[model samples]
Target: MRVLVIGGTGFIGQHLVACLVRAGHAVHVPTRRYQKGRNLLVFPTLTLFEADVHDDAVLERLLSETDAVVNLVGVLHSKPGRPYGIEFERAHVELPRRIAAACRKIGVRRLLHVSALGADAQGPSGYQRSKAAGEEAVRAEFSTYSEGALTIFRPSVVFGREDNFMNLFARLARWLPVIPLAGAGARLQPVYVRDVAAAMANALENSQTYGKTYTVAGVSQYTLAELARLAAKWSGRPRPVLPVPHFVGYAQALLFEFLPGRPLMSRDNLDSLKVDNVSDEAMAPELGVVPTPLESVAPSYLRGGKPDRGPVH
Candidate 1:
């Protein structure tokens, strides 16, 4: 199968590309940053097109030769001035709309979209709402298809070598005497990055997965406090897990969003945590996917200290 991946140079994109290549599929990654022969290495059956995906002509041209597309573009939170449209709406909402048109014109078969667990088009957080909007657009565009044409994989917190979540906490554990937690008691079920890649491959191959939304989460749930403790234990730092009030965290996020570059946290991110970031059992087995335990994968790259092997309770 010839697969076109939008935003395929990102963390999940990189893994998804490798998986598709290994499965004997011809993969083309259309990305803006990974130019040919410039710091970016090339792979067999994995072609990288350096161009803006928002351009309809470019997207159509790329879709012409591909059998299917997987949209992996997303953002956690946006800067104050940088509206959610570019970060979330463009890739999350508009891109799918354009992709659906391109697919219909070119007679493409399938589309697998990666949406966050808490994504709700009508929800509170702009990030989640935008994601939900993206899903709705894709569904609305493809609902006419005879084949189970679109699969939406909603993953909880994803953790990997290059992930911003666990890695960021780990980095803080290494230096900070105490780690501040927002929504400290809130729970999350973090899915492994590799598993997410696997799920995408399965969705692409399986015809029964169309028009279904699957929540991909880790085997177990953990609170913000537990996550910090686990990070400290894994990093061998054992930093104190300090819980910051939600309002205080929001204030801090506001202050940080004004920083020169990407802010550590944003109000949007805080808003997202209001909903539990865990997978729903009803949707898991139907997709033929079981959540991978976080402990199983965390040790590989996150091992910096002594192991803590026991139940959280």
Candidate 2:
């Protein structure tokens, strides 16, 4: 299989590309800059495609050469809008729409789209609402196809060595004396990045996952505060988490929004946390994926690794 993974240079995309290569599938990964995806050259079956995917002609040209497509393009923050932010509408809603329609036009039968687990039309955050709209757009475009033609995976907070979620907390624990938190009671079942990547890679050819909306999550659920404490403990920085009121957190996020490049926590992020991300569905039976717990992989990275900020939400 020759696979085209849009947003293939990012965290989950990198993992998915590697997985596809190991599975003996040739992969095409596009990036605005050639050097951004250069590390992927280590994978024998992977090709780095340098071009702007937002361009219609370029996207069509890229899709024309692939057997299937996986759309993992998403943005954590965007300029505010009615239903969602401008970036969210573009990355989450419009990009998927374009990919699905183009794939159909190019005679591509398989598409795997990654959406957020808590995505809802009526959700609190623009990210959630935009993600929901993206899914609808894909389904509407591929409506004429059979069930397995378009598969969507809604994964909860993804965490791994390079993730921003737990690693952010670990970084805070390392530098700050006490962590002031918002949405401290928010519930989340974080899926490992590897598991999330594997589920999407495996779903590409699985008949059971075709046309299905799956909730990909971990084996255990944790509250934001509890997870913070655990991150602190694992990172060897024991610190108390100060749980503030929602208003306080929102106020803090508002302030963060003004601080520049990728706010520590945006107002929309707090809105997202308002909804619990726990899923009752299991990926093992659905996508043949076995979820990895946070305890198993988090400690290794948190204790000794540098807490670099990652772009994956």
Candidate 3:
């Protein structure tokens, strides 16, 4: 199988590409910069192409050579706007809609979209609403097209070696003296990134997963504060997790929005925390994946980690 991964050079996408290649599938990755994806060349069955996927012509060309597609393009922070920000609309909604439409046009069959767990059309965050809209658009397109299946995985906050969620806390513990916790009471179930990748790779051609939307989550749940303290302890810092009021958190997030790079936490992110990210749905059994516990994996990574595997040249 030749799989075209739209955002294949990203953190999760890299793992998925390697997983697919190891399983004997040919993986095609598109990136704007060839050098940016050069690390992926280490995987024998994976090939990288430099192209802007948002272009209709480029998308059509890629679809022409693809048997399946997995879209992982997503933006965490976007400038605020109505419905959602333009960045969110383009990456989350428009990109998925385009991919689905191209898959339809090219008669390509399988599409697996990785969306967030708490994605809701009427949700507080633009990220949630846009993600929900993206899923809806993809489903609409799939229905119109005759010959394929669409599977969507809405996973809770995914944590791993390179993941933003756990790593953010780890970094905070390493740097900050006192960790001021926003959304300290918010509930979250964080799945391992590798498990999420494995589930997607396993679902590529699985008939059971066709047209099914699976909610992937970790084995246990944790409050934001609990997880932060764990991260601090694991990293050998063990800082005090100070739970702040919503007003203070909102003010901090607003202040972060003005910082140089991407905001540490945006108001939209706080809005997302307004809802619990835990799900009762069991996807590990459905997808033939054994859910990995955060306890087993997070400690090593939070600490310096037992030496990482070097890139193969």
Candidate 4:
């Protein structure tokens, strides 16, 4: 299959592209800068196109030869809004709608969209709400395209060697004597990046996955505090976790929002933690994948090495 992977330069996108390439699919990735996607250049089956994905002409031309589309574009932080902020609206909502429209216009049928696990239309956070809206837009557009199907994957916090989740905590623990954390009690099922990529690859070939929403999660669930502790331990820098109160956490997030570059945490992110990010056991198996456990994969990666194989049940 000829697959056009949007956001292929990102963490999860890189893994997914590798999976697709290994599966013998011709993968085309678009990036603003070619240098950013240089890591993917090793894959002979993969091609990186320098173009802005948001431009309709660019997307249409890409879809012309594309057989399947995988939309992995997402934003963790946004300014602020009623339903969602401008960044969220553009990346989460607008892009999916445009991609769907372009896919339909170009007669490309299959779409695999990666969304957040706790996404809800009336969710507490702008990020979640925007994700929900994006799902709606994709579904609405693809429902009319009788020739193709849309598969939506709502994954919990994804972790791997290149992940920002565990690695961030590990980095923080390495420097800080004691870690002050927000949403300490928030439950999350941290799925492996490769597992997610495998699921997407499976979905691409499985027609049963089309028009179905799969909640991708790991086997074990852990609290935010637990995850932090695990990261610290794995990195050989065990630190005490200080769970901040909700108000204090919000204040901390607010302060981080003003920090240079992307904030470590935002108010919307704090709100998103209010919901548990777990999935039913049946979700991954629905796509013929046994979700990887955090314990099996995190230790190998967090310790500064890649795993020899995917996690076992």
- In terms of TM-score, the best-performing candidate is 3
TM-score of each: 0.90, 0.95, 0.97, 0.96
Residue 1, candidate 4: alpha-carbon lDDT: 93
After aligning candidate 2 to the native by TM-score, how far in Å is the CA of 72 from where it should be? 0.5
Give per-residue CA lDDT, model 1, range 16-111, as digits (tens).
Answer: 777788788898887776653232244577777687778989888888888989989887765432235466777678888888877877788788
lDDT of 3 by residue, 23-78 (tens): 89999999999998898998988889899999999999999998999999988989
Locate the minimum summed-lDDT window of 10 residues in model 1.
304-313
Clash number for each model: 0, 1, 0, 0
What lDDT tens digits, residue by residue, belong to model 4 across residues 121-184? 9999999999999999998998889987899999888888778899999999988999998889
Q: Return the candidate ranking by lDDT, descending.
A: 3, 4, 2, 1
Please report the TM-score between candidate 1 and the true structure. Answer: 0.90
User: How many clashes would you count in candidate 2?
Assistant: 1
Task: Give candidate 4's root-mean-square deviation (CA, Å).
Answer: 2.2
Clashing pairs in 2: 148-210
